[model samples]
Structure formats: C-alpha cells, structure tokens
Target chain A: MFEYPALFAVAAVVREGSFERAAHVLNITPSAVSQRIRLLEERIGAVLIVRGQPCTPTEEGRKICRHVERVAMLEQELRAVMPSLGGEEALESRITLPIATNADSLATWFLDAAMGAAKRQGFLLDLSVEDQDHTATGLRRGEVLAAVTTLEKPIPGCDSTPLGSLRYRATASPEFLERYFADGVNARTLAQAPGIVFGKKDTLQYQWVRRAVGHDVAFPTHWLPSTHGYVEVSLGGMGWGMNPALLVGSLLEKGALVELIPGLCVDVPLFWQARRLSSALLDELSGAVVKAARASLLWTGAGR
Target chain B: MFEYPALFAVAAVVREGSFERAAHVLNITPSAVSQRIRLLEERIGAVLIVRGQPCTPTEEGRKICRHVERVAMLEQELRAVMPSLGGEEALESRITLPIATNADSLATWFLDAAMGAAKRQGFLLDLSVEDQDHTATGLRRGEVLAAVTTLEKPIPGCDSTPLGSLRYRATASPEFLERYFADGVNARTLAQAPGIVFGKKDTLQYQWVRRAVGHDVAFPTHWLPSTHGYVEVSLGGMGWGMNPALLVGSLLEKGALVELIPGLCVDVPLFWQARRLSSALLDELSGAVVKAARASLLWTGAGR
Candidate 1:
C-alpha cells in the first residue's frame, strides 16, 4: 500500500504547482516536501512530478493525484458521518473538487449549482472550462472527477445524468443585419459576412450556418473565446454568433439582438458525468447540478 | 520565390485547423490544398502541416504562418493606399489578427479597443486569453502578433508601450466577512477562511494575504476561472477574492462588496507589446489600445 502522507504530498505538489507552495500548504519544510516526493517516486518505481518554475505532474503523478482526490472525498464523507473522527481540523479542511464544464453552462447556471454544492458540502471547487463536446476527455484522462459534458454515454467507471439542453440562437445586431444581410441571409451573404466563433474548437456557428443555409458555408469569423464577449461583440455589430438562449433572451426581446433566422434554434443536450464513487459529496453535487439544470435548461420530452 | 497562393493556403489551414476547411476558405478543392501543402513541404524539405482530426502545425509551419500574417497586414495597407489595386473582393477579404490578452482586461476594456481596431481595419480578431504575466509568451512563440501583458520591457523585436496599471482590491461580501472574520481578520482567521482564485495561475489573493498578514498564509481557495464569474461568486458569498477595481467599483460603492483591508490595493501595470513591423494597421491598433487603457486604467504618473 502507498503511504497516505506521501500520497497527499504528491497531490499537494501537483495542486499548488510548486514544491515550496506545497510545503506551505502541508505545513512542512521545502526539503521535507522534496524528501516525501522522492520517497513516493522510489516506492512507485517511477518519476511523478516534473520540477519547473511551476511544477507539473507526469502521467503517473496525475493518476496518483486522482487517487488522492478520491480518498479525500471518501474521508470527507466519513468525517460527516462520525463528527468525532475529525474535530476542528475537519471543519477547517476544505477538499478541492476539480470539475470540468463548458463556458455557456458556466456563464448561465453552472455557478448556481456549484455554489449550492460548495455551501452544502463545505468544499472548495476547482473548475476547468472546456468546450462541451470535449469536457468528457478530462474525465477519461482522470484530470477531472466530474464534468458537465455533451456525452450522453458515460465513460467507464462513471455515472451520467441528463442535465437537459442549452438552446442557442444565431443572433446579430440590427446594424449588422442591415450591413451584411440587407437582401437576406443567403448562402452567398453568409459566405461574405463575418461571423463570431468561440475558438478553433468551436463549430457551433459552422453547424448553425449549415442548418440555416441548407449547406456548409465557410464565413469569415472573429474568434472571441469568452461566452459573455460573444453577446457583447454581437450587440456591438462585430459579428453574428451562436449566443445561448438563456443569455440573449432579454437582448432578443429588447430588440438589442435579433436572430439571423427567427425560430431557428439549436438545442445542445448536456450531461453531468461523475466518477462512480460512494461519496455523499459527489451525490449532493450531482443533485444540485440536476436541480439547477432543470430550473434553467430546456427539457424536451425526447431529451432523455 | 515562394508562391503567395500556396503561402495563403498554409495560413488558412493553420487558422481553420483543417485542410478541408482551409479549402473552403481559399475557395479551392481539398485535393488542391493538399497539393499546395505537399509542394511547400517538398521545397522547404520540412513537414509543415501535420494531418490530424484538427490539423496542427510544426515549428516551421508556425514561422511561415507568422510571415503570412505580416504579409497580409502589409497588403491591407497597400490596398488602402491604392484603392484601384483591388476592387470588390478586397473589401470582403477580412484578415484574422491573432492577439493575446488577460481575461480581466477583456472583461473590462480590451474588447472596446479591439472593436475600434476591427471596425476601422475591417479585420477579424482571434483573441488568446492568458494571464497578464504570461501573455508575452504567446507573442514570443509567434502564436500572436501582439499582446496586452505586464511585461514593461519590450521583447527583442517588439515595441512596448505603457497602458497604465489595472488596480485590484481584495474584496468580499458583508456576509462572508461576518462569517469568516467574526473575531477579526488576523493571520489565524485568514488561514482558515476560504478564498476565490481565478485558477492555479492566479496569485493575487496570496500576495494580498502576505502583504496584509505580514506572512505567507496558505488559505483554501475555490478556483473559478471566469472573470465575470469571480464577481458573481464573490457577491454570492462563496469566498473572498481579488476583484478588478473597474468591475467592483459600483459594488463597493453600493456596499455589495467590501474590501478586506481598506487603502490596500495591488496595481498591476500593463504594457502593449507588438512586433515592430512597419504596418499602418499595427500602429492604429497600438493607438486604440493606449487610448482605451488610459481611459480605463489608473495612471499614477509613476506607472510609466
């Protein structure tokens, strides 16, 4: 069995991203932190942490850190059931739960869910933002214990729960409409006009254009990665972009933003996937996510 | 001489992240795009584009792409001076200018500057968000032509202009103060209370705590990566965090958020670093950035 103390040292070094910072967190000397890491690596027969300006973990280190996180979650649950197991230190110790989520869900409802879970469980949240289509890769890589992803199917050793769909509208400002699509939004106009893309990874606008124009139309795009920036730039007549319905509903109603094609929307279904662990904290978080999603996201009968 | 047509194909493939999409943008067949890449590789005797699900570039590929971007900027300037050189097609061809910036600046003032530049030049912006301390790395790597960074000194072949310092205040909601610092915010209380962090890269809270408490206090932190989310979570009483003065000014005035320690602020001086190229567009962008920064950021004369 691995030494729990040395395992925790490995986890802290990775989390803090430096041996000195890890020592500060662990309340040990820097040399002691180094010795613990060296001992852990020797026992495992592999190098774990790569020393750098900000230390990074090797593949073996990541796996060990993931194991440490799982153990920490289980310990939290145990302390909850038996308060005497840990007294003041238990109350003060906040386990960090690293989870992956997309920008749209985070901008709209993910925080409310996260806040609720953090308050109830008294834990710190470490959120990693990624495209919804790719969030599951973090789970597969053991980088994140839970993720809000578009994958309906769960990764092995993980439980997937439907979190409903986030709807998007291809929105543009009044001035943008007049300038680019004065005649109408056709394939030719779209091919000529500039659009807004989140990044290279984002294909929302491309997919929407294909659906609206009945074919793939390659348009010039301004890549702004921020979810809120998408709305701001669109409103400022920078470019038409796929803005979430939850975000642009009021703007659309106020005539600040108009859909490129009225009534044409894309509903991207999201799922909450968490490692299958017998931890009450994870269950509580999953419940909060489902509750928040139900309150904010659209749930068509066929979504499930 | 290297063919401009094949060079453009290389830039488009790198920008679009795929040969097929590059073909769409270049208005050519995918086979032709493949042939251009193959020919370029043969001439250079080095692999340019790596064929993948979403294509990536080798080191040589990146260097070539940077050259193409500079050439495009020069061409745009040329077209501007002699309007008769190109007609309708020139007006529609919007070049993508990749720039790096910190998230706080983007949320507060960077987009306004970007909008002005984009509107005047009719170019698309591809923004890469990094920490202020690390934004220069992108510029150094040839990944971005310009950056809003904290580096006061210019890179080897770049121009660095002072953009003023963005002031930050360590803030928390009233409830958070009462709950966490009921006794008083000393080193002991600080070590126990949870804080909010942008991510592992953020050290604002740590710096502030060390300055205030007179020692390094390893406090628990909730890592929420979004700039807007930071304010929302702080307002929601999740944790105390360092918030930009521009974003939390009204909140502080309205008593929605309170500083942990009054009269103590961290001023992160920002500089605009762009490649020293003889292009009118780069000069115009530099002017816009400087103007916006002067208008929004705090300029205590010593910032220069």
Candidate 2:
C-alpha cells in the first residue's frame, strides 16, 4: 500500500472529479485529501490532478492511475493464492482479472475458456470486448492481463501461445444473395452490394471479397459491430459478412443464412498473449484458453 | 489509383490470405498477383504481407490497408456529393460513416444525433461503442470521422466543440442496496460489496464510492461492457453502478433501480471532435450532433 498509496488518492480524485469527493470516499476531510495529494505531488514532483469542474489527470497522473490499477489487481491476486496474507483484514477473496477479447470469440467460445479457468481456479473474469485486431492494444497498455489477438508475434515482455484460428465463412440471407449476386460475384457487383462489417477495424469482409472476387473493392457497408448484431443483420437481409463458424450454426441449419461462397473460408489464427509471469492463475488461464480454442477454432496452425 | 494501385492488390492478398485466392477472385493467374505484390514491395521499399499458412500483413501493410479504407470512404463521400464524378459507373449512394461514441451516450442520446444527421443527409451510421474515457483514441487513429469524447482538448488536426455533459447517478437494485449497504457504506463494506462496471475503463462506480464513502475502494465487480448490459446487470442485483440519467428512466420510476446517493450526480463533459475539413456532410453532421446534445445533455458549460 505504501508503494502506491498516492495512486489510490489520484485514482479516486480522477474518478470522483474532486478532492472533496475523494475525501468523502476515503472517509477523510477534504483538507486531508488535499494534503495527501499535495504530499504525493511533492514526492512525485508532478501535479497529479487538475482541480476542475470534473478533475482530470495529467499524463503522469494517468500513468500512476494505471499503475494503481495494476497493483490493486496484483494485491488481490496475491491474496487469492495466499489466504493468510489478507485473512482477517479482508473478509472475502475477490480478484478480478480483466481480459480483452474479440466480439466473435465472446459470442462463440471465449466464455467457455473463461468459465473453465474460473471454475478450476477461482477469479472473477472482467472481459473487455475489443476487435481481435486491436485487443493487443489493451494488453500493451496494461489495461488487460491477457488477450485473444490475431498477431502471430508476441508483444514485448509477454508470452504468445498459438490458440488455433477462428473460422469465418462468407454468409448472407438467401434473398440477399439471390438479388445481389444474381449475375455472380464480381468487383462491380461487390462495389454496389451492401455489406455487413464488424467495425472500421474489421477486415474480414474485405478478406472475404478478396477470396470471392480476387480483388479489393469497396461496397456500401453496414457496420453491425456486435457479434449477435452482425449475425442478425446478415439474416435480416441487410447485408452479407464473414461470420464465425459456430454462430452461423443454427441459422445455417434453418437456411436463414446462405453461405455466399462455399468451401472458401477465411481463417483468422488467434493467439493467447499474456505476461510471462510465474503465476499459477495465468498458467491455468493459458491452458484453459488453449483447450477451448482447440476444441472450437479451426486447426490451421499447430496450437501449443 | 496510381498513388496506391498495388496497395489494392496488397490488401487483396492480405485479405484473401494468399496470392492464389486473390488471383482467383481477380480472375487472373496467381503468378500475376505475386508479380504485382513483388513490384508493389519494390515501390514501397517494405515487405507488406508475410506469406504463411494464412497470410498476414506487416505493420507497413496495415498502414496501407487503413489508408485504402480511408480512401474508399472519402471516395464514397466524393461520389455522394458529385454524383457525376462516377456518372453511370456507380448508382446506389450508401455511405457508412464510422463514428465512435461512449456506451451511455449511444444508449441514451447519440443515436438521435446519428438519426438526425442521417435523415437530413443520407448516410449509414457505423457506431463504434467505446467508453467516454477513451473515445479519443478512435478519433486519433482516423477509425471514426467523429467521436463523442470527454476530452476538452482536440486531437491534432481535429476540431473540438463542447457537446454538454452526460449526467449519471449512483444506482443499484433495491435488493442489492439493502443487502450491501444495510450495515452502512464504509470502506470495509465497499471493499466487499459486489459491483457492476461497464469495463475496466469505467471509473463511475469508484466515483460513487468517493461520493458515498468519501474514499477510494475496490469491490468485487462484474464487467458487462455494453450500455444496456450495464443497466440490466445493475438491475439484476449483481451489483451497483452509476447509471446514465435517461437510461434508468422507467426502471427508476418502477423502483427497479434505486439511487444510492440522493442528489449527488457526476456530470461527464463531452465534446464532438472531428477532422477540420470543409465538407458539407461533416457540417450537417456537426449541426445534428450539437442539436441532439443540446436537447438531451446538461448545459454545464457554455456550449460555444
């Protein structure tokens, strides 16, 4: 606590937006919160928070807030394994590990891995949903402990393990395909057809185009960023997209969504990236994630 | 096309995951795609895609892909304004504008902004839901044309205008409040009480702690990450959270969610940040956004 005591105050001020309010939360007088901030600023040689309508953190202060979050997470982590550590002082062990994952994975298989890990080794899972292409950013910022990413290479100071590939196939409602692709898939038709995309960061639809039409072409796109929304929109005949293999199951069986291009699928190989820590919980997480991915995702590469 | 002709090819190869598939889509020989890629690499002086089990793009390649996407978007914008630019080449005028918005805003008032903009001027709203604390990242990356962000300062090469503040109050299901705060909300109780959070980035719950207990404390929290989910989770009695004013409407009336603190509310100031470009479409968008915010958001500061 001494190592990062000021950080809690700084975080409180940033979160609460004022010293007085932070004091209220800490059960101290506003002056005490101010004194602690003053002492902390003097110690750190930087003004941590701007006293404004809603207080904001300086760049340095933000770094401290992030550090505080990390340390608090670790402290809970420590108490989780070593119960005697915070025993009487802490009534119950509550450790939340925030992990970044893709929307597709969340709808399909990510939770199974999370639940498996939680059941075997108890820890609350706080999932932060970001596109697979960008989930690594959260990991880099220490905003998340682990991530499901498409990047093959490991982030610096992190361990990367292959976690199989999330399979996607070009799909749309039969009515949509019948109307739009009546003349067959081509650059001109693709350029005019409405397409469903995950978001700006999503490249799967474009990849589908390259595989189906053999060129990169832009079309009128409908961005249904959520996994379920993407599927629902595709089924509603709004547009077509590359949907996760598992999510299309019931729809495919019911013939609600027709595969635009059969046998031609895109494979986005995923990897579990985590800090190279000698923590049993992380090790358990890695195993659970790998197991789930292997069971669900396509085997394009060796997942070890 | 000449500036980045081969870029389209490179993007195709990356998307298709192989030169052969890209060639197939293009109705050309695989060798042709390979040759174009080689020439493009020579021109850029950087290797773009790594040929692999499933091909992937390098950092330089990703930048090129992003550039292609931006160019495509701008092209659509251009064709929208000057229909004769493409003349008979293109017909349907469906342009999707990617915009980043905080979840609370997205659920409460941002859609009206989007709808107002869309109705007056035709365009598709590709809304990317990010927390208010971090929406600026999307703006900086050019992933979104505009964003509803908390930062008062504008990103470089972007214009910033205050859009008013989103007011939120600490709320929980009556049962949750009764169970957790029955003994009174002190640091001890807060540390053990279950909490609901939007994501790791969400600090409103902590702000509530600062307001209620007068200090910084951590609680066992469930992360829902979506706007509706945040309310649903809080109402489900999983825990307590600070909810946006309008989102808790009927639930508040019905006592589904009870305010933990009676009048104390946090006002998160928002700003509309967009590229400093002279485009009528952008102007229309700005007007609609400001209009919507004014009608819904609190006038904490002089908007101008």
Candidate 3:
C-alpha cells in the first residue's frame, strides 16, 4: 500500500516547487520532507523529484501527484458529510485545484467561473496558461486536473463537455487596412504585409488566412504574446491580427478597428475536460465553467 | 567555412517550430529544408533539431541558433550601409528579435518600446514572458537576444542597464480588508487571510508579506496568471495582492482599493539586459526600452 503521508509530501513538493517551501506549507522540517521523499522513492524504485533551484517532478512524480490531488478532493468531500471527522482545522485547509486554460478565456470569461468556484467551495486555484490547442497536453501528462481545450473528444479516463465557440475577427486599424490592403487583401498583398501572431504555437492567424485566401501565404509577422497587447498593437497600426470579438467589440463599433475581411469570422469551439472522478467539488467547478462559457460564447444555429 | 544557408535553415526551423513551416517561410521545399538541417548536423557532429509536433532545438542547436541570429543582425547592418548589396528584397526582409520579459512589464511599459523598434527598423519582435526574477535564464541559455530582469548584475556576455524600479503596493478592496483584517494586520492575521499570486514562480506577495510581518507566514493563494486578472480579482474583493502602483493608482485615489499598510511598498528594481552585440539595431531597441522604462517606472528618492 502507498504511504498517504509520503504521497502528500510528494504532492506538496511538486506544487510548491521546493522542499523548503513544501515543508513550510506542510508544517514540517525540510529534512523531514527530504526523508519522506527518499522513503517514497525507495518503495517506488524511481527518482520522482529532480532537486534544483526550484524542484520539478519527473513523469513518475506527476502521476503520484495526480493521485494525491484526487484523494485530497475526496477527503474534502468526506469531511463535508461528517463534520466531526476532522473539525475546523480540516475545513480551513484549502485545497488547490490546478487547471489549464487559454489566455483569451482567462482575459474574458474564465475568471468569473473561477471566482464563483472559489467562493462557493473555498478552493484555491493554480491555473496554467497555454495555447488552447495545446492545453490538452497538461491533462494527458496529469499536470492539471481540468482544462479549457479545443479538442472535441475526451482523453481516456476524462470527460469532455462542449463549451461554445470563441469568435475571432481578422481585425486591423483603419490606417493599417489602408496602408497594407490598399491594393486589396490577396495572396500578393498578404505576402508583403506584416501580421501579428500570439506566439509560435498560435496558428489562429494562419488558420484565418487559409480560410480567407484559400491557401497558405508566407508573411512577415510580429509575435506579441500578450492578449491585450494584440488589441493595442492592432489599434496602433503595428500589424493586422486575429483579435477576439469580445475584446474588440467597442473598438470595432468606434471604428478604431476594422475587419480585414468583413463578415468573415473564425469560431473556435472549446471544451472543458476533467478526470471522471466522482467528487462533488470537481463537478461544481465543471458546472460553473460550463455555465460561464455558455453565457459568453456563441452557440451555432440555436442562438446569436 | 560554415554554411550560412544551412545556419539560416536551423534558425528558421527553430523559430517556426516545424520543418514544413520553415520551408514555407524560406520559400523552399520541405525536402530541401530537411537536407540543409541534416548536412548542418553532420558537419557539427551533434543533433540540432528534435523532430516532433513542434520541433525544438537541442542545447548545441540553441548555441548555433544564437550565432545565426547575431549574424543576421550584423548582415542587416552591412546591407544598410551598402544599399546596393541586396537592395529592396534585403530591406524588406524583416528580422525577428526574440526577447524575454516579465508579464507586468510587458503589460505596462514594454509594448511601446517593442512597437517603436518594430516601426523604426522594420523589425519583428518574438517575446517570451517569464517571471522578472527568472527572465535572465533565457539570456543565459542564448534563447533570447534581450530580457527585462530584476538582476542588477549583468550576465557574462550581456550588458545590463538599470530600468528603474516597478513599485508594488499590497492592496485589496475595502471590503476585503475589513473582512480579513478586522482587528489588525500582523503575522497571525496574514497567516489566515488568503492572497493572490501571479503563479508558482511569483514571489512578490511573499516578499511583501515577509516585510510586513517580519517572518514567513503560511497562507492560501489564488494563482491567477494574468496581469489584468490581478487588478480585476483585487477589485472584486477576492483577495489581497501585491499590485503595481501604475495599475491601482486611480483605484486607490477613488477609494475603490486601499493599501494593507499605507506607507509600505516593495520596489523591485528592473534592468534591461541584452547581448553585447555591436549592432545598431540592438542599440536602437535598448535605447527605446530604457526610454520607456524611465518614463514610466519609479526612480527611488531622486524623483516622485
């Protein structure tokens, strides 16, 4: 049988990213934390933690950390049913739910759901931000409990629910449109104009271009990774980029920003995927996320 | 002699993160791109690119990529002087400068400098956001040409210029302060009250708390990784956090947010670090960054 105490130590180390910080959180000595990890490693016959300036978990450690997190969630649920099991200290011990999400969602609508979950359940959140297309990798690696992703299908041992599409417009300032697309936005013009990309992982601009022009076009790009920076740079006529509709609504109305191609939008469908664990807290979080997403995102054929 | 074309191919593959994408950017066939990479690897006697969904550079590959980037900058300068050497196509070829910076700096002051550099020199910026304390890692690894960092000392081959301090105040909504610190602000109260942290790597809140309380205190934290989210959450009465003065100045003046302790502020001194390359473009970028930082950040006792 696995040692629950040692498992907790492993989880704390990974979460805090250091033995000393984990010790402080666990209310134990650093040496004691090291000994517990050593004992756990001997039993498992593998090096779980890679000690460094900020310690990191190996693949084996990540699996163990995931197990401990689920166990903690279950324990919290049990204590809720029987208050006499642990008392006030147990209630005050906050559980952190590590989740992965895209930056645009966090900037627009995800925080309301997160704040609601935290207030309702007294849960702390450890959010990992990644590109929407790549957020599923965290779930696959057992690094995050839940994720906002672009994958319609669920990974094995996980549940997937459809969150509506986040609409994006190929937006540019009036000056930018006039300066670059004066001759019109075709393959020739696009190849010469500068575009804004979120990062190397982001393909939103490429995807939108392929849809608009019917083929890939090589263009010069300024890679600015901030979501808000995208809007600001576009407004400054730095480059044309795919800006989220929700963020650019007022600008578009004010005529500060214009669509490179009017009436053409990209609707990227998102999903909330979480482990299929029978815990009320996880279900509550999933419910809050789905509710927020449904309220803000566009639903096809059924609603505007 | 080293092959310049093959080196450019290595840099492109790493920048684009896929051989096919590199080929598209270089206007070459995929097989031709592959051939260049293989020949470079054979000559170097080490693996350069790790083939995957998105290709990455090995350690040896990073060194070579850095070399190619510097060469590109120098070549651009040479063509600038001798206009007849390459002419329109050369002037049109936009060179990307990969830079590392903290999110707070990027959100506040860095974008202006980035936009300025891009406009003046026809450069493209590839920005990587990391914690201020850790931004220097990219410079040390030769992954980025420049970085905004908290380290006062320069990295071995880099030049560091003081960019003034980004002052932060421990702030919360009036309701939050009343609810959590009804009696007073001390280690005892701080240990029970929740805090907002940017991420696991963020230690700003901890540093502020240690200064306020005179010792380490264990507290629950909501790890929201967005700079704008920090202000929103603090305004929503979610938790107290170390917020940049620039963001919360109006809120403080309007009585929406209050400092935990009125006069205690943490001043994180920032510096601009870049490779000590003799390129005019690098110098122009540095001048722009230093100018922006001076205009926005605090300069300690000498200025308000």
Candidate 4:
C-alpha cells in the first residue's frame, strides 16, 4: 500500500477510464498502467476492475478508490495546515457546528455547506436530527455547537439568525380529497379526513388547519414516515399532505394533485443558531445556510 | 495512542487501584505499563492520569479509555465473526441499529445491554428518545431494529415480549407537599396542585392526577429537561412529580423524599420489540436483552 509508484499507477488507470487514456494521464506508456493494475490485483488477491469497453470498478476497486480519495484529501489538508503549527505554544483551534436537517438535505446541501466552509477553516459539523421541529434540542444539550431550527426562540446559549421560511402546500389527489372531504373541507370535518404526516409532532397540516379554521385537533393520519415517501404517497392520492413547494412545483403544474386551499400554506421559518462564542467556522457555515435558504424559500417570513 | 500495548490499560489500573495489579491482569511487567502510559501521554500530548498510590483516570484519559474500549470491543467482535475474510469482505457486515429509549434507561440498563450485546456480536447501537409512550414510531421508520417501550402492542411486522411493569409514584418533597397541600393531602387536592412533567407529551403524572381527581386540568410546570434532574427537582421540593420506582428507591429508603400516594402507582408494562427476521446477530442480541431484563426488571411471566 505504501508503494507510491504502484498506488499512483492504479489511480491513474481508474481516473483515465482506459489503459490508453491512463498512459496519457500519467504521461507514461500504456503498458505501465496495465502492468501496475495487474500487480495491484495480484498483491491484493482480488480483481479490482471488470475489463470492458469503458472499464468499470468492481466492489473492491470502489472501496479502494474511496479510501484513496479520502487519504489524498486528508494529506492535502494536513499539508495546508502544517505551517500554522510552527509554534508549540500556539492554541489549536477547531470549531464544532451542529445542524439538524432532514434526510434529503443531509444527502445533498449539508455536504455542500461543509465543503464550502472547510475551504476557509478547520471545523467539524456534528449533525443529528430527530425532526425539523426538535433539532434545537441538540443545541440545548450542548451536543452541537450550532443548529438549524424551526423554533423562533433561541436555545439558552445560542444566537438565532433567520435563514428563511420553508413553504409547504396542502396537496392531495383529487380523487382522495373528493372521497374523504366531499362535504366541503373544514377543520371539524377534516379531523376525520385521512391525511399523511412526515413524523409524529410534525404539524404542518394541523397548523394549516388551525390558520384556515380555528381549532386544535390531532389530524387523522397515516404516518408515511419519511420526507420522500410522504410526498410519494400524497402524489399517489393515499391522503392529503403537506408537500414542500420545491418538490411539488412540477407536479402541481402537471395537475397531478390539487392544493386543498390556495395561499393557506404554512411557512416554517428556519433559523441558524450558534453558540454565543465568536467562531469563524460557524460564521462561514451560517452564511452558506442563509444563502441556500434564500434561494430555496419563499421569504415571506409569515411565521417569523 | 499506538504506543500503548493494548487499549484499557488505564481502565485496568483504575479498576484494580495499582499498577502492579493492573499489570498482573494484563500479563505485562509493571514497568511496561508505566512506559506505555508515558508513551501514550507523549503521543496524545496530554496528561492522562494523576500518579498516586491509588489510580485515577484524568478527564482526558477517561474519554480516550471510553473510545479505546468501544473500538477494541468492535475489533474483537469483527475478528470473531469474519476471521478469514479478505480485506474486502471484512467491511461488509458493519450495521448500525437505531433505538429509542428514555433517559433513565439510557443512563442505566440500556447502555449495559447494548455494550454486552456488542461484545457478543459485532454491531453498533444508535440511540434516540421519544419518552415511553411514543417509542413505537421509531419502529415504523425501520429506524431501530428494536426498542424498550411502555407500549405492550407490537408494531406491525415486529414481535414483542413483555419485560414487566415499570411502576411510577406521585411524590413531592415533604416541604413542597406541606406548602401546596396544607389540608393533609387527599386525592382531590393533589390534582389541583402544580406539577412537574418530563416533557409536553409525558402523561404519567396527568394520568395519576386524573385517577385521583376525576377531571383534567393544566398545572404549572418547570421543565428541567432531563430525567435525573426532573427527579432531583421533585425531591428538592420544586413541585409534585411522578418518579420511577427504579430511580427513586434509594431516596425513598433514605428518607430524602416521600411517596405522596402509597399504593397509587402507575404500572407501565414495558416490552422489547424487534423486527421478525432470521438474522443470527439480532437473535443473539434480543435474547441477551431478555436475559438482562429478567435480572433487572419486575418479571411477570413464565417464572412467575
């Protein structure tokens, strides 16, 4: 593994797609890439690549490439920070930020923000989530150094910045709504009307009902149990549910579903709350989240 | 960190109270333990222990020992299961089991059960909380493989074994009881008195009050937001609260707190439910949990 020439040879083949292109990438003979890959597979006692026109990575090769890429990034980062550790007395500073986000955000925007922030500072993001509403509890426990929350009030030791409002529309299949709420949709009537919810304590529809018709009641629900699946079910007309505007915009345009009540949507105003301490990493991340929120949300700030 | 011959060297020293004893347990010379400690400190660049006749792990040492013990246990279990795997196959079986549990159990029996199970089999436990009533929702997401819950009914596609009742008592600090209920406390007066709750959805005290008073009404509260802290506040005369029998036994016997309603206890039958699967690892773990539960809980079946 420590043989740099051998490791680089295999990496070049993987990057360049084929033995011919690998030679170009490495500025070496094609035979070198082929020979190196052969030696690596023999040493490891496993096939690393599936020989084909385009050349595909085997499961083993994918693992190796992942490890290689991580090692490369870590080494580069270490080298970049090595100069700052010149003095023994220097304080080693690392800021930890915590964010509570849904699964979709975790698989996408969260990583983007982390990469964007890491360019300027050495930081760790401690992300944990129960749901959108309860994400602030991590901040209260001091488990996270910062958080993105739906709560307006700041957790005791943190400062709050309004990121933006997440707009949600009450949508359902026309067939399902017609079957369930045929007697004209009202709060008392919709109490028995079947609906789908993201999770327990997720009250987007309840809040919508309260605003449209003054009442506080547990909406009858089939807990679909995920951000993605809830939208899928609502599209499937299993029940009426709150769909994030971004996900449903195209669907609404296509007349796949009808909004239960137009302009009676709920705006969950998200905030970035960080510890009172002045932290450069937290500031950088806060900026990125605010930018993302602005681009994604309607920004009416009705809830705020 | 690598300089230490093995993990848990400091833990052995602390548990045994001497370097010689620790060395005997580890099958190494005392001088080797001392040298390892010195080298470990040098590597981490922090003082880990206070040198004394008896042993004590420093705050930093405790953290490292904890991390070392977890990793060591994981490594041992991994090797035990996949002894002859090539590097590729060795990484395949790492699975994380999510669980929902209340704070008291999390700090006590749950951690012990998880660690013991992990020692017997290689797996990771990720824990979250939803109080006693709502733990079932965790199962709906396929988030947790199993949970310790008050709900007796099994979630769909899961099996539940009754772990016995967790009895809770309505108690107050002697002073607070005297102050709030001066009419020599009876059922009716207790309901109207201010109460302390674990959270918004925690209905233990409310149910007890309803049984006592025959009506529902809001009582003032101070949310300490921790299970142990809530019990402590109740004992300190903050307000009337429901205390778990497992948690408050010592305090009751020591005369630090009083049970306001003797024989008027809420018996919540807890259950251990897991997905019905043919996996050997989950089978062993669920069985171990039942065994541990028998030893620690109020068992009510088979042996009864």
Put down candidate 3 lDDT per residue, B1-304, tens digits, no spaces: 6787788889889888788778888888989999999988988799999998678999998998999888878878888889687733422367888999999998889898878888889888888899998999999998999999998788999998999999999999999999999988998788777798997778888788889888777687788888998898899888899999987899999999999999799999999999999878889999999999999998763532
Candidate 4 DockQ category?
Answer: incorrect
Per-model interface RMSD values are 1.8, 6.9, 1.9, 25.5
Stretch of 10 with least lDDT, candidate 3 chain B: B85-94
lDDT (Cα, tens digit) per residue for candidate 2, span B1-304: 4555477667656544577656654556788878888898898799988887357788788777656655655676787779778722232234456678887886677765665575456566677778798899878876577899998798997899898889998888898889888887788778767676775467787777787777677566567676655675577666778889888878888988898767878888899998776656777888888889988999866535
At residue A157, candidate 1 shows an lDDT of 94
TM-scores of the candidates in the order shown:
0.97, 0.61, 0.96, 0.39
Q: What is candidate 3's TM-score against the reference?
A: 0.96
Residues B1-304 of candidate 1: C-alpha lDDT, one tens digit per residue: 6697888888889899788888887778999999998998998999988887568889999989999888887877787779787733422367778999999999999998898889877888989899888899989988898999999888989999898899999999999999999888888898878898897767788788878988888888788889999999999999999999999999999999999888789889899999998877778888899999999998886625
For residue B32, model 3's alpha carbon misses the true position, in angstroms, by 0.8
The CA lDDT at B22 in model 1 is 86
DockQ of each: 0.67, 0.17, 0.63, 0.01
- Which one is best on DockQ? 1
Candidate 2 per-residue lDDT over residues A57-170, each given as its tens digit? 887787776666566556766776686776322322445566888878876887766756754565666777888998998888765778999987899979998888888989
Candidate 1 — number of clashing residue pairs?
0
Q: Which pairs clash in model 4?
A: none
Deviation in Å, model 2, residue B149 alpha carbon: 11
Report how far off residue A228 is in candidate 3 (Å).
Answer: 1.1
Location of the lowest summed lDDT over 10 successive residues in candidate 2 chain A: A87-96
